[model samples]
Target: MKVVIFSTCVVDLEFPNVGKAMVEVLERFGCDCYLPSDQICCGQPTYNSGYEKGTQRTFRNQVDALLSVESDYIVGPAGSCVAMLREYPELLKDDPEYLGKARILAAKTYEFSQFLWRILGVENAGAELNGKATYHRSCHMTRLLGEAESPYALLEHVKGLEMVPLANAHDCCGFGGTFSAKEPEISKQMVDEKVRHIEETGAEILVSCDPGCLMNIGGRFNRLGKPIKIMHLAEVLNSNVDERRITYLKQMPV
Candidate 1:
């Protein structure tokens, strides 16, 4: 399948490796991937902050960039950003020029893990990581994108990896984009609680599908002098891959 990669701002600015890993994994699955040079932020940072009017141009720009090349799918590493991309249809519904384009863009977009499990029918990527780790479910991914299982399903197949249950895994890490910036003290307390729960799991590494949450919780860990390692789901899934063990579902599910 031909895939267009939607590189989010966080991945482009802070977690370039996660984007690279995502591309590697997709290519491994025989996807012809294209990264649009014109792609930019999905406007979640401003839109979520109640700047919907100002975010329209950003939404249009992203649509134009992703559609610049015809592809079967538009995949992204971060669920939060992917969710934002999926909202373009509704966000621009009233725009006569962009509404139809927005719908087409939204229809083909998928978060990295979601595409692997749902579209590619991949059960295992043959990754091996020997360490205790717990996953943080980002609010946007779980609630907005409605993808609560794809990450866990893929993670279950990673050899030598121990997945621990995170306490209150559904709780937000307080990185609601500008929310963390606007309410620093509140954000700190929320992330502190998140870190405390992560510590309770006794996991050596923290994993999450959303970079913002990882940045929030990981930053809290750093400020508190915690030694826990942080990793994005793409990075974890791309580790020590064994080609011989890679397997896909016998049939793609509806």
Candidate 2:
């Protein structure tokens, strides 16, 4: 199957490797993936900030970029961006010119995990990771996009990987884009609490799909000198199976 990848701003800017990993995973599954250069932000930040009118230009450009590419699916690693992309239909519902285009794009767009497990019926992408890890059910990916089980479904198949339940798994990571910047004190408190819960899991690594959430929690881990490793879900899914076997043998507890 051919696919057009929507490299979300966070993965494009802060974690380019996440984008690369996503491409690797998709290709491993026999997907012909294309990353269009014209794609821009899905206009999530401005729209979420209550500036729907201000988001029009970016929204239109992204809609065009996404629809112009002929592919079976338009998938992205970030659930937050996918959630926003799926919203374009509603955002342009009243505009007769763009409404049809928006709906077309939304119909084909999907989050990476959702695309892998739900759409493709993939149990595993042959990933290997041997470690106790906890998944942060990212707010946009879970509550907003209503994809709570897909990531876990994919993770469960990783050889030698133990998945732990995060304490208060449903709580927001406090990285609601501008929310963290606008309310520093509250954001800090919320992230701190989140990190504390991650620590409670006793997992060696924290895995999540949204780069924004990883950035928020990873930033606190750095400042507080915490030892938990933050990993993108894509990276883990695309891990080398040989190295994973080695890790499983060496790291498995007696």
lDDT per model vs. reference: 0.92, 0.87
lDDT per residue (tens digit) for residues 118-169 in model 2: 7777766677888999999998888779888888977888887899999888
Candidate 1 Cα deviation (angstroms), residue 220: 1.0
Q: Residue 238 in model 2: shift from native, Å?
A: 0.7
Candidate 1 per-residue lDDT, tens place, 1-254, comes to 89999989898999989999999999999999999999889998888899989999899899999999999999998898898888888899899999999989999999999999999999999899999999999998999999998899899999999999998988888898999999999998889899999999999999989888988888889989999999998999899999998998787756
The 10-residue segment with the lowest total lDDT in model 2: 245-254
- In candidate 2, list every pair of residues with a backbone clash: none
Lowest-sum lDDT 10-residue window in model 1: 245-254
TM-score of 2: 0.93
Q: Whose lDDT is greatest here?
A: 1
TM-score of 1: 0.98
